[model samples]
Target: MKKASLYGTGALLFLALTGCAQQSKSDAAAQLNDQSVMALNWFQQSGEYQALTYQAFTTATYAFDKAQSLTGKPKAVIVDLDETMIDNSAYSAWQVKANKPFEDKSWSRWTHAEQANAVPGAVSFAQYVDSHGGIMFYVSNRDQKDYAATLANLQRLGFPNVNAKTLRLSTTTSNKQARFDAIKNEGYNVVLYVGDNLNDFGAATYHKSNAERRNFVNSNHSLFGTQFIVLPNPLYGDWESGLAPGYNKLTPEQKLKVRADALKAWDGK
Candidate 1:
């Protein structure tokens, strides 16, 4: 009887340990899933917006530093307002929550709709630039028709010293070179160009492959940290385009395959 009781107790202990181990694994998986959901939610919501505002602060300081170094003094820091100076989180969230993909038509409608708010630190930075006699030019890719709403949004956000004419959109020009040229023609030494997209610098030249993009950055690494401050926008950008060009071209299975292949490459086995 003693031997039987001892064996039974041992069996019970083993079962309990096994159950505990399974519970622990289940708990770990649940935690991982929760974290992933939160991360996705952040990207869909305010992550980029928050990043842009912080980048704006960095850009302001960097440009100010460059201006301080110049001989005759740098004149202006050209800024792109959409992703660079405004928080478009609500719109992003709306899209994700509604299961709507990011399409240009939808994006254009969003841009024209005037729903984006001023990014954190953007208003303060712009005000600082104005106070320091630094000209702020809004060289955005937003359509010309969006000028009115864009201006109104900026004004509503209390961005100081902004004239309606200072905001420019692509009409005749295919790229930002023309706008940069215009600034140069106006006889103001442009100290910096702040934006979240590659096109904001010079669209035609910068929107190629990953190698070309990296080369561009390498060629201008000196200016990157100081003059050309980049704001983060992981949810949408050239990077996403590089990863998955036009979702219409790829079926769900194809996308999964591409993602799997990418992971395999990372695994090196």
Candidate 2:
């Protein structure tokens, strides 16, 4: 009877420990979600964010007009869709409100809802490019499954040239070099690239560490406003994943620890 009593107590202890661990993980995930609240507020409510986006698009227009056109190849401008051309912060805000992690299913549903707002000045820039002897290619890493809904959303927002030929979605790889190459191979004189992520410019910064990403930016400092336009996206990005070597695969508690350790805190004098 003592042995059985001891066994029951051990089982109960094991379950109790397991429950604590699960709760700790849940808390960590909640904390991570909470951390995004400030970023979302800035993105959604700040005039600075709108001003920066307008600045990017305005620079992009100038760059497109200044780019020398070839004899045969028509001028083309490559732009990323999400966060660059359209705003999806509502979905991100939903994630925070619901205390949910980003998942493909929820993202797909959001895309299908066709509620994304156009980034400030994005529509005007796109129309300018489309009308002024340039092809605007909407190259994005959004999955192919969301293509139809994405097309509809862009169309609803009055984004020009969003048809099947111009809008390209991810087929196999998220690395967009192949799609970029295909557009070039099709005889378009690619003039400028625009995006929120460095990887949107090319494969150079794809999956790279933050150090490498910064180095690439430093190396190509002159191209910022002219050849590569950038939009602000502090909500979530590969930069978060770049905090640690397998960050995406880490458990919630581990990810929280990684984020904490990555901070460069000052020592009290």
Ten contiguous residues minimizing lDDT sum, candidate 2: 236-245
> How good is model 1 by TM-score?
0.72
Candidate closest to the true structure, highest lDDT: 2
C-alpha TM-scores of all predictions: 0.72, 0.98
Model number with the top TM-score: 2
For candidate 2, lDDT tens digit of each residue in 150-176?
Answer: 999999999998999999999999999
**Model 2: per-residue Cα lDDT at residue 14:** 100
- For candidate 2, the lDDT comes to 0.94
Query: Candidate 1, overall lDDT?
Result: 0.69
Report lDDT per candidate: 0.69, 0.94
Model 1 off-target regions past 4 Å? Answer: 1-40, 43-52, 68-74, 244-265
lDDT of 1 by residue, 35-100 (tens): 334545664466675665676686667666556534565478788886678867666665655545
What's the residue-level lDDT of 95 in candidate 2? Answer: 93
